[model samples]
Target: MRLRLRRFRPRTGPHEHRVVQPLHPLRHASLRDPDPIGHLLADHDGLNRLAGLFSFAAYSRHTVVHIPLRDGVPPDEGMGELVDLVLVHHSYGLRPSQWPGLRRRLTHGTPLTVRTDEARTARDAAAWQARAHRADRRDELRHTTHARTFFLFGSRDVFAEAADSFAYAAGNGPLHKRVQQGDLALVSAIPGLRQPPGGGHPFEVLICFKPYPPYAHFKRPGR
Candidate 1:
């Protein structure tokens, strides 16, 4: 599900390589606090402003989110305000009376919890590309990883360390839809981003305001 969005055009020698996200400053803003969940919601009002888009429906857990393209505002404007990836909870367990083919993935046992950490592996260009496709697939073949991380999780022990090798599952698609996860962040695709209340130079900018830090699937340095 590739959504036709706008992008930024370079003005000089080479194209700028500045990447941004939807949930950033807020991530470290309250780093001294305890509640990771609360820290995740510091500037949630920005995300809440997009309630009409995200939700937690299926999956081993019902955690869902919806990404909204502010009408005529192009992705470059809302990049940091939202993410470009997600976990694969879409076609999971389903009840015959509810969603037959999708109700068996999470059998209603103990709610699963995911543990997140800074992905050092991503710093390696080769490693980053090896797992790039699965990190934050807003689409099947389109990708870009700048400020990504490693989202680790497990079932039996919600607090246990993450699985040996984990990845960000893909979602339905990125056009006219809602909710997803990945090394996703809301960065301004184009240079001049102008959204409500926070429009400025660079045309637009990704405000680093996500539930988790962007997860880079890892790639080769100069890829």
Candidate 2:
């Protein structure tokens, strides 16, 4: 997977700045695939890539990645397409004021506990509701996590831009309901420099966002 670096800034409020730690795929040949368990293996008791400012994890059989930008990029035109999955750790992902709450949650829990797990549980519940609402559940995609990680599913044509609201629209009608349900967020599609092993099919982008109240204000386009 290819990686890009960026930063997050709160629109308003006090913030705790996180350090930027880079992920080197070359260090671990086994990282060819962005597997959640792979990330844990790489964690090495929180000393590995999983502990870095930017990292990836496996959630619900999908590769979930996290990234912490050093400077705010504001989701501009320069944003590229990501290959596999990306994890973003920043206060902007959630409401500006909720940062402290998130930090407290993380600190109060076990050292290894990730606050995002709370959202993931919420996401699973939402997905179950979605399934119940649908008449045909065979093809339904479950909302596995609520980390606000954007995914392109290897669709390089997907594009993203800075928006005044938390919502996004790519003109995919069938996805509208899912987007509205907070199952996913639209983000600028970025091209990662790394390709899959043996130059196989295109990789996708998955970004795990920081949990906070700021996240509740997301208003997608064409909602």
Candidate 3:
């Protein structure tokens, strides 16, 4: 039998990258911690205040967040909040099902873990030019390194302060829908960021708050 080589599909395009799925068995096991969502709700008073402001229209770093009508706020009133959690680096959309996993990790103060395929290698600059479409993607395949990072957010003002420089995976659909429904929306920051800068060794951490299905397939890094 003749073997056919499978074509590589880049993680791009509007709907192509949207792989929102449920937690894998192993990831589900990690969520055994006691009521993590409740803990977060109890902890952040600032989050509680601005939790209602979730819907926004973004262009570049500028976003106009619309406050819901529940607080008797004017329907025409659009509150401005900065967004820093745009999932640009990776193209996959955020999965609502993974919220529990994220909650578990946050409650335990554990960094989100990711395992990439070791077989795939990063394309060189010349190679990247050949595949010009993936211009936003960083890191070489062979150089895939593990990152230990946690999520962070303060007041809704902070969220409204900076136009997030990152991109979101869900394009602009469910992300807006979930927030409108009053679902818990959050952004995770790279780990060790809370400490003063220049205090720890320099490490590159990804910013996009994309929670993938447990054990998602990754191409082995190429040499």
Candidate 4:
């Protein structure tokens, strides 16, 4: 199925801060379309399609996906750009049912209370670190000598800032620090939407400059 792109502008209000309930597992599964990962792994065409979506969101400044905090409250404004990019990158892995709600939250605004506490935040940060390590290991095994490094961030502001830094470093940095041609400086932001090893997040962002040959396919018109 072709993925449709839409602009999202979330609304926020003081009284909208109530926690939204989670959906039942079977019901949730029923709402999702077939996993796009299968298509992505199938060939470069699939990968390029995904890259197109990313370019669209980045250039258009559209928040195509929304990942609420654990309590269903939207992430702060500091997370706007990074959050949109991260979620769009991972949208192929999300359920269709989840998309509607996420989009609604983004468009309608879910100002309901921010339920995160210090302990929860710390735990989430640690979990994010562990996930980043795993991603590092995977890259190492896949690329061997060419494996890229993972940069982890706990704060939303820093994570958002790193997006720009990565872009600059990827294209114009010194040889040792720059991302090589055909590779991408990518960001992985986890919302902990799935269960166990996958779900629950301190909503951390992890950036890496890694091999991605399809990078040339989705460049903006003039650039």
**Cα RMSDs of all predictions?**
20.7, 19.6, 20.8, 16.3
Segments of candidate 1 deviating more than 4 angstroms: 1-86, 89-100, 103-107, 124-126, 129-223
The TM-scores of all predictions, comma-separated, are: 0.20, 0.21, 0.18, 0.23
lDDT of the structure predicted as candidate 4? 0.27
Model 4 lowest lDDT segment of ten: 139-148
Using TM-score as the measure, name the better of candidate 2 and candidate 4. Answer: 4
Model 1: per-residue Cα lDDT over 159-184, one tens digit each:
11111111111111111111123223
Best by TM-score: 4
Candidate 3's C-alpha lDDT?
Answer: 0.22
| lDDT of candidate 2 over 1-223, digit per residue (tens) | 2223222222224644331223323121111123221111111111222322221222212222333221222222123321222333221243323334433332221112232232333344344445444556432211112222222221101111111001111223213344334343232222222244576654432322221124356444455
- For model 3, residues 31-135, the per-residue Cα lDDT tens digits are 101111211110121222222121121111221111111212111212222111221111122333433333232211112222221112111222333433455
- Looking at model 1, report the run of 10 residues with the lowest lDDT sum: 164-173
C-alpha lDDT (0 to 100) for residue 25 of candidate 3: 15
Scored by lDDT, the top model is 4
Over 4 Å off, model 2? 1-33, 36-177, 185-188, 207-223
